[model samples]
Target chain A: MSETNELKVREKQEVAPSAELTKPGPVFTPHVDIFETDNSLTLLVDMPGVKADDLNVDLRDDILTLTGDAKPSLATPGEKIYGEYETGRYYRQFSLSEVIAQDKIDAKLSDGVLRLTLPKVEKATPRRIMVQVD
Target chain B: MIYRTLFGAPGRRFGASLKELEEMQQRMDRLFNGFRDRSAGRVGVGAGVFPAINISEDTGAYYVSAELPGVTSADLEINVTANQLTLAGERKISKEAADARYHRREREAGRFSRALALPGDIDADNVKAGLADGVLTITIPKAEKAKPRQITVQ
Candidate 1:
């Protein structure tokens, strides 16, 4: 790896408790990258150890909520000797703007990463307005 | 995960009130979230390591696991020699369009190298690794001489 390509380590941060949750476990705020194009917004969420059936993505009243539980699927049975990380669930929420088409949003989970595509509302799509001359 | 259940280290207990206090602190942190640059993954505080790892041991082998979300096996390189295990990989995330506007950018992409010293010698030829659900798990069996043998209590 080149000097510039060296990856700096960043510890995982837990999501602050903002509401009453029944589940009991450390909930991490998954890392995410969000970008927008002319017609849609793309969100890439990193959620390692979470399976497709264990993830939940909900959008209600313009609020988008994501939750996933990380379970040990690989059989690496042994006594704990040392641990640099703790297993836990992931939770995050984002309030969408009016431009997003909440009903048209789509989500896919692959290799522990969740990709969400949120298409814009029809009238919100960006387009150049041509001037009409007299 | 089984590790979560196995993490009952001695002397760390949280009573009901203490748990409530933790929740209160978390709520306060969110209140002042704007003051901190939370958009960058590099700035967040937690365990303070990239691709957090865990190690476990059985009578005959040692198991090591690391989180590498969105990273494929093709990008990773693992080497074990004597008692050291070196994990080197480049995490390549698809780049956004040049004109694409970003609302929030936290996930990062780059090369990372981590070398861990094992507790005992390993059978390098018998080492096995697998990547599933973005987690890389390596099982390293101990060398014949490194394995502890129980003598018959004659």
Candidate 2:
């Protein structure tokens, strides 16, 4: 929480078929699951068809951003018979809270889920103080 | 008939929100108002639940993809017939933590099934499926006659 107000997350609708999208092609906002544990916050994002090499997860100034560029898997040599689902890019961002240990963020991708774990700092955890009897 | 089914048995269904009723009222008003918005010619929308999908076609094959975040490959099942394709899957919720509480939950977990009628000339043997980043992509090759062919002038 800071003096400058910023939304924790924002989803841009870049794939409206009525030509409301400004980009050249469609770019979907990947859905994410954010779960808070005692020690860390786990984020699981879905970005199908996105290889590890094409994904970029960056953190700058407490703002964490995820960008993935996926090739058109539907662009096959065979002639088209029926179709649904377009191939496009993916983007998602989150404002990391100060209680997290920024340096120790861990990320993993498997079976289309991008898991990012942001561990809490020492100060954020609870501590016990012994009573002093005089 | 829809109105009768949704709200017809008024005493049976209770506690529906005013906003939802108002939206339904507006839809009813549009239906009975007798004024057609010819300018905005759009297809009728489907029931608002479940994932949304799109379909496209080419000369040689068919492509279909479904948005299934939080669903694993093992949870998915696909079936292809001579003129039909079926996708059925379930998204399971994690139960690892006994004391975990949610402040907000937007993602839903449930079983979803969608079926589409494929053209009769589908080559079922060459169908391929891949799941990545929560999306399911299926490629089905068309029959020999369905593929594009060219003729040369002598």
Candidate 3:
């Protein structure tokens, strides 16, 4: 209820991609903040270099997959002095429960953070039952 | 135009504290050990993760980008000396819910400082810092003498 954008941040599970193929570069599992409200679940993922055009979020057979390529700004005109960080792609996926209204999922990206909203079904939300007079 | 500083001996590296030095050593080990666990996409060490940075330079400026997923611009501070750049920041734990429990906890929250010696003089006046998503980018313009110049032979 405290979420203003209708995205209640909650707890969710995620794992990195496990494809056997050799990825050209390092693939990072983005850090995410998942929240849930009475009606929906929201996920806030950190993907700094990933742009809107390069991002892909997919849902298939109750599995939600997220993959994106971050264009490395590591390229510079001057000779290399030093490097300490690794740059590559961002990928993560999560499984949705049956109570989730998967079709109404929404995703938005801003300032490198991806916010995803997955609404819950009407049966999943709590409703107060009225007491009958005896 | 000075390449010596690139290999300059650490006549002193920003006076690291005891705790910072320990963290720095762990980072070096992580690099050498090549603990790139394909499954977790991270080193198994919980508290040994150092916010790695890439520092590079062009004709005009020196650029530095640090990987800081949860850190915001307001939580960070950037300082530029004659030949040093220091980035200080803190990552805080979200306290929105008190009943939440983490299944697999890897990320941590704490203060971090990365002090790097610049390869050249900094313009100081035109230094720009920006935070996009979770990455902090700092562009420090090279001093007048450091900018590459082409001279003609007549």
True contacts kept of each: 0.66, 0.25, 0.30
Worst lDDT 10-window in candidate 1 chain A? A1-10
> Can you tell me the DockQ of model 2?
0.18
lDDT of 2: 0.66
* Selected candidate, larger DockQ, 2 vs 3: 3
- Residues B61-95, candidate 3: write the lDDT tens digits: 98877667667788788888898988777765456
lDDT of 1 by residue, B1-154 (tens): 6766656542354465588899999988986673554332122333455666788899899999988988899989999999999999888888678877988878888888888899999999989999988888999999999999999998
Q: In terms of TM-score, which candidate is strongest?
A: 1
| Candidates, DockQ | 0.31, 0.18, 0.23
Please name the candidate that would achieve the greatest DockQ relative to the true structure. 1
Give interface RMSD, per candidate.
Answer: 4.3, 10.2, 9.2
Give the 10-residue window scoring lowest on summed lDDT in candidate 3 chain A. A3-12
Order the numbered candidates by TM-score, best leading.
1, 3, 2
Per-residue lDDT, model 2, residue A19, is: 38
1 against 3, candidate with superior TM-score: 1
Positional deviation of B60 in candidate 3, in angstroms?
A: 2.9
